[model samples]
Target: MNRKTLVLPAVIGLLAPVLAACGGSDDGGRAGGAITVGTTDSYTASKEAPAPLDPAYAYDAGSWNLLRQTLQTLMTMPRGGGEPVPEAAKECGFTDSGNERYECTLRDGLKFASGDAITATDVKYSIDRVLGIKASTGVSGLLSTVDTIETQGYKKVIFHLRTPDATFPYKLATPVAGIVHPEEYPRDKLRTGFKVDGSGPYTLRAEVKGDTIAKAVFTKNDRYTGQLTPKNNSIELRPFADADAMGAALDKGDIDLMTRTMTPAQVEKLSSATTGDVKLTATPGLEIRYLGFNTEAPVVRDKAVRQAMAQIIDRGQLASTVYGEMAEPLFSLVPANITGHSNAFFNKYGAPSADKARQILSKAGVTTPVRLTLNYTTDHYGSGTKKEFEVLKTQLDRSGLFKVEIKGTKWTDFRADGLDGKYAVYGLGWFPDFPDADNFLAPFLDEGNFLALPYVNSAIRDDLIPQSRREADRLIASDSIEEIQNIVADDVPVLPLWQGKQYVAARDDIQGVEWALDSSSNLQLWELSRGVSG
Candidate 1:
């Protein structure tokens, strides 16, 4: 089920001498003057933490959103909502009885940002590039069902799927499908520093890396002329080593914009600071928190064992203790806003009960404590993560029926460890690709999907996903997604924790800060520029 909305929180300026002391920009609305943003998003430019301008590897939230906006997909939701908006392709239709042969008719007179006329060859080359780098990129898996991608005229491209996929167009509208200049981009790395060439509104102009790089300034993309909501000529994306240091930098007028590692405590502190020039936006929607149990492990394979363990989690108390009132109990993998999601799990599980858990364990012939290891990313999910896990460990240990060992790993390494089938228990947070049941269903259900968890459920993997993909109706798609989720809740291989709250800080001068489906919340720079500049 596909759903979309455009809403960004706005606050009036909190201007004072204190705010001026910290920075020039007010914390209220944005006016598009000089803006310095700060965020604690650290990424290394190496093979392990490789820097990829290519959209296919746009896995990280920060990079994905920018690349998504900078590059144009063959089709897009102009409002960033539902279905394809036909940015590149004017008309799209389906052929073949199984709905596998999808054809598209494109709009002519389009050119790459580099001034090269777009052609069917360019389309082929762009897609073929991702298909080529399937191994290193991790993008190959997202497109595994594709049999072939063909082009008819300079404007039209047809995708032949091994199986029927109705939601393929939605996928096409995603950043992963971002079309790049075929002439410049070859099999591997992007050519130069932020020098992007695409048929989008914005064109990459200048990108200064660090104080180490030649230039240390950010500027507007020259090629951007497409109808956009662009408010600022240039938006600066700066990474801070830590949130505290970044917070200090923002106070000292060192940065203009910020994201990543933003928490409630930080927002509360920064927003209410005597220097309250920075606007803090309260973003809403599916920022999900959950505990993923490796079902493949022999210890978790037993349903009684897993269910008993889930029963021991004090979700309500835990939510209050770790997340405070900012979070809610997640009963289903799909959030309430997502189509077809109901509190079905809540109806089934209810509040945590230790007596029932002990009963289940006793029935399973488990007399002693169930020893388990819980894993999480130390630096990725902000400072509150380890504390949150500590609460969970305490709750589980309080049951007196289980022994828990908590393990923390860095973000990049934690994923590799999961892929190696190393951890039996781990904490995972999901920021959706799109606001739909499909995003919830596919990620958690598909065995070949994320974490490479072998969630081999034929009904979900083979039937449900294919069924929802072909059925274009959102309600129908939601029904399929809901049925699949019921299976997930019953399986209890993973336990729901809490859904997160999105926060963004803008100056009173700024406006039009739209939240993207993937939780890549940035100022919709176009819709918001200088608002009544003083």
Candidate 2:
């Protein structure tokens, strides 16, 4: 799931089983043209409605994009037509010196839906504001490498960095760089629960937060003059609280698209349930899952204990039992098909062997009383997460070397607890910065490693990162990545569980379903359409 290069989601075609729900008496009009998508995570309106829209403080990807409508970036994705182009800025090449300064120009007539000209001041306010509010949650980490962001003019933005990071442009492409409304938010105060005001194609129409249901309906902004080529003219994003409930809604034909959490069996149910009418397509995604260790923990400080734990987990059984066959065993931090990735951890610890695991812990003098608490998120991923953790507890307990205790928390509590290094060991899943190896490396390997594995690899932080980001040649980049992998293996910070697979079901009549790209499963939204069967 982690990768060293810009990669898209893996595309896995569906193995469908025709079922009752997806099949029904078909009338002449194409299967009720509107598609109903489902997801489990319930969305909430932070009193500000979407206030943290400030790029320096924006956290979620969707809200970032929505607010980006009003803001602008210097460059965009798809070197030459990757997919839907962003509004705001046009593409330009950076200096090969890696991290060398560069500039971008905004397309003519671009302005906020509010009629405010998107000048460089807005860009400066969005980026520089991040460094100003670094103390807030996730803001500092996102703004770490940003040395300085300055505006040359109304349309041009210049970024001078503390390091020569060639990947800065791509980072800008992420929602993290989504422009913000300077008129609405102030830099000093991290605005929370504020409505998102952007120049994007859609505007926040309404919100419903009670009962843990948050929904935002958007309509075309006549004032918008950006790159987002809208197809449907409007979209509605609704967040559901439960994954199973969301799945049921999809089966009952309540939404058009579903992206969140779904087990393999449930996926199979949807694919089969739809028969040929409900199309299920998978894309290689930047979405990644890993086991994180809190270095502050005494037991985990021992290399043998960590190594032994890495050795005994059976990914194959775990995937099938909990995630179903949809989950694949992940061996490396960087995902497959991405550059700068290596299975070093897998090379160090092969298949499971509890007997051998016991010996390692015993040799390390970790007596029977050695107890490890495994933390699991009750609501973040999906329904089977708790059960999966229970299985992990069983495996570790069966070893008889260490007593394992299982703990569960909702996503909010889990994130706070995990970030504070409260749990000795926890699980993490990443979507990616921009589907690049740098994203996988920078966030995890930099001075402040996320898992509380505080590793300060000066070479990686200073030399390797700059060198890799600067080099365009894939082969040379591979060498730098190999070095990074070697260092990761030597340190053994995290164990890669598996690259998760997502199943998306749409009506057969829908066209332009590329189901590709490993970045984020958030489709272009513009690429999908429904009409008469071909």
Candidate 3:
């Protein structure tokens, strides 16, 4: 997922039988009550009003969170970590040895919230629309492997891929593959306005203030024929400008539960509440925060300069001083819990050394006191960014080998500037699209990577990554991640800083706190409830 957006994950084994046995259980509770959630526009279903309520066009986590509840995909990653299970599909699997062809048959008696019959044609149309519209924010890239999509009558849909991709099913679980009403969403244009025609467990009704969505009300869709059933009859999403506002509402009981917008300070305040009114639960996340370099920038282009910068920065100090224990030091692009993660940066640079940095710079003929500007978003990344950069500047300046200038902007502008290659050095954070090691590759290494930084390592982009994607066994594919990490360490295109843990702070009455986060770190609102006191 884009640093500007948030996304999900899990491992796989047997899927078809597991889904068949589990079928969906609504045993915990009967639908009643209402859930009011508060979050920032950063987590909204659409980045802007009039952008379309279509899931095919959504690119952010807030939107995806909503989409996951309201739109049924062929499969879905269940809460807490496991395999992607059948959701809309009764069964799905690869049809050939190449892993290039896949097929799925829809669950019988399916219908959109509009009462239109759901069929294989709608599935084919939804996938075709994503690839056809090709919106800048749309997830068409998730289907890049698809050569063509064919449907057989109203039940089966088939995908013919350009090459083998074992992770294809995981992609099917993402918002990109969300199924929409065939007649409502146009084939070539995005459907506008605040309302959505969907087939998930919820039907959306929204309220707009001026040009932005002020509130969204989701009611249980009685027509939904999937495993997940709403625990509550209605869910209200209230968007705020920042975490402090959201936290205040939660404290005042204006909102029953809160999901993605809380900042560190707000989290601390709620967690340490003397009143014991709020509770906090954390999910182990695959999110990684790092500093990226625009290799085309005149000041940061040199490999030695990048290496020197890496040598002088101390992640341990940054973690304790700037982030507290909210994050832990990350020495590789891929986090430690994942396979192929190695402390390559640590092995090459050792401990922070100003003297070593200076020696390396001098050997490369870089004059004393190299100068550059450090960039970050003041709010997009949360409340600690300003201090994080301040600490970073101090660390490099104290070395006596560098002089630094710091700059900050809000998320919208910062993302635009970074994408345009305006920053020499900038901070970026990623919430993975999927949990596999391969996710760490294409976004940062492939030709014309998501960074938009002018970096195309032929050995990595052309050879290593493509070779790795062909391996169905992730363990075997992980061998390539080691080589990729070592290459990135040498190239220094981006420096891995820390990996974060997910936090959900809500009223003590809320239950299913543990299952709210799927393995990929995406919020599962369907799992949430109130008055359970769990």
Q: In order, what lDDT does every prediction score?
A: 0.63, 0.61, 0.75
For residues 281-366, what per-residue lDDT tens digits would candidate 1 score against the true structure? 45554678887777778777777777886777877777777666457778888776666787756676677888988888788887
What's each prediction's TM-score?
A: 0.84, 0.86, 0.88
User: Per-residue lDDT for 190-247 in model 3, tens only?
Assistant: 8776667788988877787754578888888888898785666777889887778888
lDDT of 3: 0.75
Error of 1 at 139 (Å): 3.9
- What range of 10 consecutive residues in model 2 has the weakest lDDT sum? 1-10
Candidate No. with top TM-score? 3
lDDT of 3 at 511: 59
Cα-lDDT of candidate 1 = 0.63
Steric overlap count per candidate:
41, 43, 2
lDDT (0-100) at residue 264 of candidate 1?
58
- Compose the digit string of candidate 2's lDDT tens values, residues 1-534: 110111223422221222113223223123554333455654444432334445555554444444443344554454222322434776444544665675656666767777877777777777776667653336346556677766766667777766655566666666556666787767787665636666766566546555243665556677766565554455565667676677666666677556666666666665455233455555455567777876658868776787787778887777778887567777777777576678776776677888877777788887665688988888767777788788888877777766889898876667667767788888767766565566676677775444445546789878887778676564567788878877766566676777776556555554444431224544454444444432
